[model samples]
Target chain A: MEAKNSAKERMVQSALELFHQRGIRGASVDEILKRSRAGKGQFSHYFKNKDGLVLAVVDYLEAIIRSGQVDSNYSFSSWDDFEGWFGRYIGFQKEVDCELSCPLGTIGNDLTNDQDHLRRAVKSFFDWSTAQLARFFAERKAAGELVESADPDALADLCMVVMEGGMLMSKITRSTALFERAADQVLSYIRSLR
Target chain B: MEAKNSAKERMVQSALELFHQRGIRGASVDEILKRSRAGKGQFSHYFKNKDGLVLAVVDYLEAIIRSGQVDSNYSFSSWDDFEGWFGRYIGFQKEVDCELSCPLGTIGNDLTNDQDHLRRAVKSFFDWSTAQLARFFAERKAAGELVESADPDALADLCMVVMEGGMLMSKITRSTALFERAADQVLSYIRSLR
Candidate 1:
C-alpha cells in the first residue's frame, strides 16, 4: 500500500520537474515513467493520460508557488522588503539554473493551440493570482502605502506580466540578470506608487 | 519554377503557423510537409532538418514583426500619436484571435531545450529589439517628451515584458481585454511621461 502511494507521488513530482524543464509535449510518457521509476501500469493506474498527468503537475506547481510561507518575520514592511522579495524570487531561479519555467506560463504557452482543460487550469491561476495581488495592492493603498489613484487590478496584473516576461527572457538568455533588472524596476514602480 | 518557389514559401509559412500553434518539438516534419503540400524531397531541399526549418521560420516571423515598422514621430510631437501607435500595436493582436504568440516570447519559450543555432537566433532578436526600444525611449526623453527620471533601458525592457505577459494572458483567457488593458496602462505611463 505504501509503495502504491509513493508511485503516485513520484509521478506528480517527476511530471512537475519534467514538464517545467522539457515542456509538456517535449517530455514523453516513457521519460516520466522511467524517471519516476514507475512502470506503465502504475502510470495508467494513476493518470488517465498525458493530459491528466499535466493537470496534476500544474496543481503541484501552483501549490508550491502559493505556499508563500516565508518566515513570519519576513514580511513586506517597506519598498526594500518588496524589492527584496522580487530579488529573492529571481535569485532562486538562478540558484536552480532556471531548469524550471513558471509552470503556469510554460503550460500556458504550449496550450495556445488547443483550448482544453489544461488551458483552463492556466487561466484560473492567472486570474486568481491577479486578484490576490490586487487585494494586496488595495490593502496597501488603503493603508496609505500605494497611491489611491493607482488601479490595484491594473498594477497587479502588470506586475504579473513583468515577472512572466522577465522569466521568458531570462530563460531564453539563460541569464538570471535579466530577471533581476526587471524585478528591480518593478520594485521601483511599487516604491514610486505615490 | 514559380510553382516550386510558391511551394517552398507555403512550407515556411505553414511551419511557422504550426510551430507557434503547436511547438518546436511538438510539431513533426510530416505535419509541416503535409500542410505545405510538399513532398519529403522538396522539404529536404529547403531545410537540412527541423533546426534549419526553424531558423528560416524565425527569420520570416521576425521580418513580419519588424515590418510593422517603428514610427518616426516622436513622443514630443504628439503624445496622442504615440498612444495611438501603442494602441494599434496591442489592438492588432485581438483581431488575429490570439493565434500568434509574440515571436520572441514564443521562440524563447521553445528554445529552452534547443541547444544549437535555433537558440542563438532567438537570443539575437531579443537583444536587438531591446536595444532599439531603449534608443527610442532615450530619444524621447532627450526631447523632453518623457520624464527625465524614467530609465529608457528599464522602460523598454518593461514594455517587452508587458507585451509578452499580455499575450500570454490573452491567449489563456481567450480574451483580448487583458492585452487592451495592459497596453492602455503603458500608454497612460507614456502620456504621463510627457
Candidate 2:
C-alpha cells in the first residue's frame, strides 16, 4: 500500500513538473511515466489516465498554495503583511528568472473549454484566494482605512488579476519588469485609497 | 503567384485558429496542414517547419493587432479613448464566451523555454504596446493631468499586466468577473494618479 501510494505521488509530481515546463496537452502520458520511472501498470492502477493524473496534480497544487490547511494565510491584517505576501512573488520571479509561472496558473491557462472538471478545480483556487483578499479589504474598510465607496470584492479580484497577469507577462518576457511594476502600483494604489 | 501566396495565408489562418483552440504544440503541423487543405510540399515551400509557420502566424496576429500600420493607435489621447480601448476586450470576451485568449497571448503562453525566436516576437508586441501606453501617460503628465511622481512607464506596464492577467483569469474561470473587476480597478487606479 505504501509503495502504491508513493507511485501515485511520483506520477503526480512528474505530471505537475511536466505540465509546468510544457503544457498539459503538450506533455504526454508516456513522457510523465518515463520521467517518474513508474511502470505502465502502476500508472494505470494509480492514475488511470492523463486526466486523472492532472486532477491529482491540481489537488497537490492546491495543498501547497493553501499550505495544507483549510483556511490559510490568505487574509492580511496589516500593510506590511500585505507587502510581505505580495513581495514574495516578485522575489520568486527573480529567483526563477521568470522562467516559470505559478504551477497552478500554468495548468489553469493550459486548460481547454472542454475540460470542465479541471476548470472548476482551477477556478476554486482563484475564487478562494480572491475571497481571502476580500476579507482583508473588508477588515480595512471596517476599521475606516478604506473609503466608504470601495468595493472589497472588486479590489480583491483586481489584485488577483494584476498578480496573475504580471506573472504571465513576466514568464513570457523572461523579465520581471511587468510583474514588479504591477506589484508596486497595486500596493500603492490600495494604500492611496486608505 | 497569388495562388501560392493564398495557400500560405490559408495555412497561417488555420494555424492561428488551431493555436487559439488548442495550444502551439497542441496543434500539430499535420493538423494545420489538414485544416488549411494545403499540400505538404507547399507547406515546406512556404514555412520550413512548425517554428517557421508560428512566426508567420505571429506576423499575422501583429498585423491585426496593430492594424497593418507602422505606428498604430496604441496611444489613448483621452480617458474616453482609453475606456473605449479597454472596453473592447470585455466585449470580445463576451463575444467569444471566454473560450479563447488573444491568439498571440495563447501562443505566447504555450511556448517552451527553448523557443527564443517566438518569445522575442511575442515580447515585441507587448513592448510596443506598453511604450505607446507610456506615451499616453507622458502626454497626460505634460498636460498637467497626472501627478509629478507618476511613472508613465510603470503605470503603462501595469495596464498591460492587468489587461493580460484579467483576460487569463477570465478565460480560465469562464466568467468575466476577474477581468471586469481588474478592468474597473486599473482604470480607477490610473485615474487616481491623475
Which structure among the candidates has the greatest TM-score? 2
On a 0 to 1 TM-score scale, where does candidate 1 land against the true structure? 0.89
Q: lDDT tens string, model 1, A1-194? A: 46665988898988877778867887889998899899999899988888888888877766666675432112344555555655665765787676455667888788745557888887787787777767777878988887767887877766777767767777777777666666666666666676
lDDT of 2 by residue, A137-168 (tens): 99989999999988899889888888888778
Model 2: per-residue Cα lDDT over B30-133, one tens digit each: 88889989989989999878899999999888877778342225657787887766677777788889887666677888888789899899989889889888
Worst 10 residues of 2 chain B by lDDT: B68-77
Clashes of 1: 0
Residue pairs in candidate 2 whose N, alpha carbon or C atoms collide under 3 angstroms? A165-B165
TM-score of 2: 0.94
Clashing pairs in 1: none
Candidate 1: C-alpha lDDT: 0.72
Off by over 4 Å in 2: A1-5, A68-75, B1-5, B68-75
Q: Which 10 successive residues of model 2 chain A have the least lDDT summed? A: A68-77
